[model samples]
Target: MAWYATGTVAVTNGSNVVTGTGTQFITNIKSGDIFIALDNGLLYEVDQIVSATQLTLKREYAGVTNASAVYEIVPTTSNLKTLAQQVTDLIAIYQEIPQSATDAQDAAAAAQGYRDTAKTYQDNAAASASTASGAATTAQGYRDTAKTYQDNAAASASAAATSKSGADTAKSGADSAKAAADASAALAGNWAAQASGTVDGANYSAKYYAMQAAASAASIALPVPITSGGTGATTAAAARTALGVPAIASSNTFSASQTISYSQPLFSINDTSGTGVAVLQFNSNGSMVWQLQKTSASDLNVRRYVSGAFVDVPLSVSNSTGVATLAQRPMFGTATPWDSANLPSVSGRLLNIQVFTSSGTYTPTAGTTKVIVKSVGGGGAGGSTAATSAGQSAVGAGGSSAGYAEVLLTAGFSGVTVTVGAGGTPGAAGANSGNAGGTTSFGTIISCPGGSGGAGGNPSAAAAVNPSAGVVAPTISSGTIINALAGQPAPNALVLVPGSVAISGYGGSGPLGVGGQGRQTTGAGIVGAGYGVGGAGATTSASGAAQIGGAGRQGVLIVYEFA
Candidate 1:
C-alpha cells in the first residue's frame, strides 16, 4: 500500500518500542516497513507490528522522547532486499557457469603465443643497445674537435676588443686638444677687439674711460648748473633764491608783521620718536588766538586762547579708531538741552520683586511707584478608592485646578495685606472624596477661588465601566483685573475588567503650574507640581488593597515693582 500516516505516535529515547495513540499499525504496518517520526524527522525500519496501536523499531530511537508526534509508515516492496542477501545471490549466479576441456586448451595456446612474442622483443632490444654505444663514441670525438675551435675563437675576440679600446682612447685625447685650442683662439680675438678702439671714438677702451672719470673727479665747478642736477649756487640763501623756494630756519622773529603763503603745504614737522607732540598756533598781534596740537600718536586736541593761557575745547578725535568723544552733550535740531532730573528713564526696568507664599504684608520699595500683582488660588486634591476583590477594580477621579487673577496698582498704592491660599488635603484610602481648596486674595484688589475635589470610584466587575466626571472651572473676582483666567478641569479615569490594564485620572492645569500625571496598574497617586496645580487620582487592581490619592499644590502671590 501507499505511505500510511493516519494518526500521531509517541516514542521514548533509547527504546525500541513505539506507542501509537490514534493509529492502526497492525493493519497497515509489517516487518521491513519504514517508520518515520515527524518530530525529529528520523526514519527506522519496522521490526515487528505488535498491535493496532503499537510497533517495534529495528534499532533504538535516537531522538528525545515525544509523547505525541505525527508519523508515517512506508510499506516494504518486493524489489527491496538486504545488502548481504544481494551479495550472496550474485555469487551463486557466477558459480552456475560451466567450463570445458577445449576452452582450457585454447587458453593454454594463447599463453604460448604471448611468450614467443616477448622473446623476439628482447633480442631486438639488445641489438639496438649495441648500435647506440657505437654512435656515442663518434659523438665524443666530434665534441673534442668543437671544443678546440671554440677556444681559438675566444682568443681572437679578446685581441680585437683590446685594439678597439686603444683606438677609443686616442680619439678622446685628440678631442680634448682641439677644444683647448679653440678656447685660446676665442680669448685672443676678444682681446684684439677690445684693444682696437681709439681714445676719440664713441666706443673707447675701459682704461681710457677710467682715466677720463679720474680727471673729471679731480675738480668740480664752484657753482654747478641746475641742468646738470646741481643747485647752481654756493651758499644756502643763494640756492634757495635760485630754486624759487623759501629758506628754512630753526627759529625766526619778524618785526614788520610779515606774512608767508604757499600753494602747497607750507611746512612739515616730523618727530623721530612716535611719542613726540607737534603744535600749530595762530597769533594775532603777537598773542596766540588758537592752537592745534597732536597730544599723542593717535590723539589730537584743539584749544582756544583764554585769559593768559589756552583752554581746551570740548571736541577731540582719535586718529587710530576714527572715533570722536565730546565732553558736552550736543543739542539736536533746535531742541533744548535736557536737565539731569528730567531725563527719561529706561522702560520696563525692574526695581524689586515681592513674593508671598503665606499670609503677610506687602510694602513697596523706596522708589517703587507702580506695581503689577498676580495671584492664584490653591488646587484641590484627588479622591481615593476602596479595596477591590478578585475580578473587580476601583479607580478615582482627578481634581480640578484653581483660578488666576492679575491687576496693576499705581500711584496711591502703599502697604497692603496679602493672603495666600493653602492646598486641599487628599482623601484617605478606601472610597473617599478629596477636600476643596482655599481662596487667595490681594487686599480685595484681586481674588481667585479654588477648584473642587474629584469623586471616588466604585468597584466594577464588568468588562468596562463609565469614567468619573471632570470638575468645573473655578471663578475669579477682583477689581480691574487685567487678566482673569479659569484653570482646566481634570481628566476622566478608565476602568477595565480583571487581567486587563486600568488607568486613574490625571490632574488639571493652572496658569503658572502643570498638573500631576495619572496612575496605571497598582500604585499611589502622584503629587501635583508647582503652584495652583491639581493632584492625581489613585488606582488599584490588587485584591483587598486600597491606595491613597495625591496631595494638591499651594497657591502663590507675586508683586513686580517698577520705577
Candidate 2:
C-alpha cells in the first residue's frame, strides 16, 4: 500500500459534509480544523478521530455544549445508495417533516466545502481593508504637521529679517556719531597748533575733547537715555558754558553753536538811493528769532559751533568776500554813549548815540536836544550866466556852489532858521549856462551845493571865458545826499526811524547831472543810478542789492540813571 498523510480535524456541530469521487486532500486544514453538521435535528462537531470508519464528536442542541456524538463510515459506493436509503427511510418514518427541512438538507449537501472556504476569504478581505484605512489616516496627519512647521519657520525668518534691518540702521547711526567725535578731536588738536598764548594747552585740550564727545553723543540717536550729552532738555546757554565758552553772558539763551541774528532799525533809511537793510534772524530749534541790525552794508551768514569750534553756515551770494557771519567773534553786545561836550569840529562827522535801555528812551538835559537826521534837502542850483542875446560884449558871473550842514538843535533853538535850498533859479534858458546848487544852513553854518556849469564863451568878444566844473554836493547834505564811492549803508541808517541815534541815514546815489557828454541824454533826476534802485521818494528807502549791507556800528548811550 502507498503511504498517505492525513491531518486531524474537528468538525463544527452546525456544518454539513458531502462525499466526492476523488480523495479529498483538505490541503489547507491544520490539526485543529473543525467541521460542524446537523443530523437528525441535532448539532454535532467531530472532536476526535479513532479511525477512518469511526470518530468521536461533540453533540449540542440550541447552543448547549458537551453532548456526546459518534460518527461511522461505510465502504465507498458510486451512487452513495446506502446513505441515501438511510435518509429516505428516516424521512418516511417522520411523515410530518416540513419542506424547509428538506431544502436545508439539499443545500448543505450541495455546497458544503465551498461555503467554508468562501467565509475564510471574506474575513481576510475585511481585516486587510481596515488595516489599509488606518495606515492612510496616520500618513495624512504626519504631512499636515510637517507643513505647519514649515510655515512657522518661514514666518520666523521674515521677522528676523526686519529686526536685522533695524539693527543695521542703528549701527549706521552709531558710526556717524563716531565720525563726528573724531572730527571734533582733530579740530581741537589743530586749535592747539594755532594757539598764540602760552597757556596750559593740555587743560584746554582736555576741556575741548570733553565737549566734543558730549556733542557727538547727543547728535547720535542713542537707544539709551542721553543724560550727559549735548543739551536737549538743557538750555543752549548751559550747554555752551559746560563746553567752556569764554566770556559769554549767562543770560544769553543761545549756545556758541547756535546762530544769533541782529534786528534791523525800523524807521531810518535813504529814500534817495543805496542798498536797503534786511533784519537779521537766528534759526533756533528750527524757528527764526530776531537778533540785531547791520551796522555797515555787507553780506551776512550764520555760524554754528560744532564740537567746541565755530563753523560758518554755507552761504550763497555774489561777491561774498569781507562778508560777516554770525559765528565770527566779537559779536556786538550794545552801543556806546554820546558826548556832546566833545563836539566834533569836522563839518560832516557823525556822532552815534544809544539808549541805555532796550526801550531806547532818553530824557534830554535842558540845553541839549538829540535827534537822528535822516536826509538833508538838496541844495539849489546856482544862477545862470548874465549874458543876454548870445553875449553881446558882457561877462557872466561865476555860478555859486551849494552848502550843507547837520546840527543837533538845542532846547532854546526854536528860533533856529530852517531854509531848504532850492536849485538856483535857471537863467534865461536860451542864452545862459546852467546855474550852481545853493548853500543851505541851519545856524551859523552854510550848506554846500552842487557846482554849476560855466557860461559858453562868444566867438569874437575876447572876454573872460568861464568853464563850469562838475560840483560835488556835500555827501552829508539834508535830503539824503549820496556818494557813488560809498557802497550800501548800515541797517540803522536804512531802516531806523528819525530822532534816535539808533537810526542811521542811508547814502544817496550818484549826483543828478548830465550823463557823460550827451547832455540831452542825461537820466531824469533820481536817487540811485544803479540797478534795482528805487526812485527818490518819501518813506521809500533804497532797494536791496544782489547782496545784503554791513551790520550797523553800535551807538553810544550816556545814561544818568535816576534809579
TM-score of 2: 0.18
- Give the alpha carbon lDDT tens digit for every residue of 167-213 in model 1: 57778555555555455555545544443332113223333444544
Q: Give the range where candidate 2 is weakest over 10 consecutive residues by summed lDDT.
A: 514-523
* Residue runs of model 2 more than 4 Å from their true location after superposition: 1-369, 372-400, 408-417, 433-439, 443-453, 460-465, 469-563
Root-mean-square deviation per candidate: 46.9, 71.2
lDDT accuracy of residue 112 in candidate 1: 41
- Which numbered prediction scores highest in TM-score against the true structure? 1
TM-scores, in order shown? 0.41, 0.18
**lDDT per model vs. reference:** 0.64, 0.29
On residues 112-151, what C-alpha lDDT tens digit does candidate 2 reach at each position? 3333444454454555555445545555555555555555
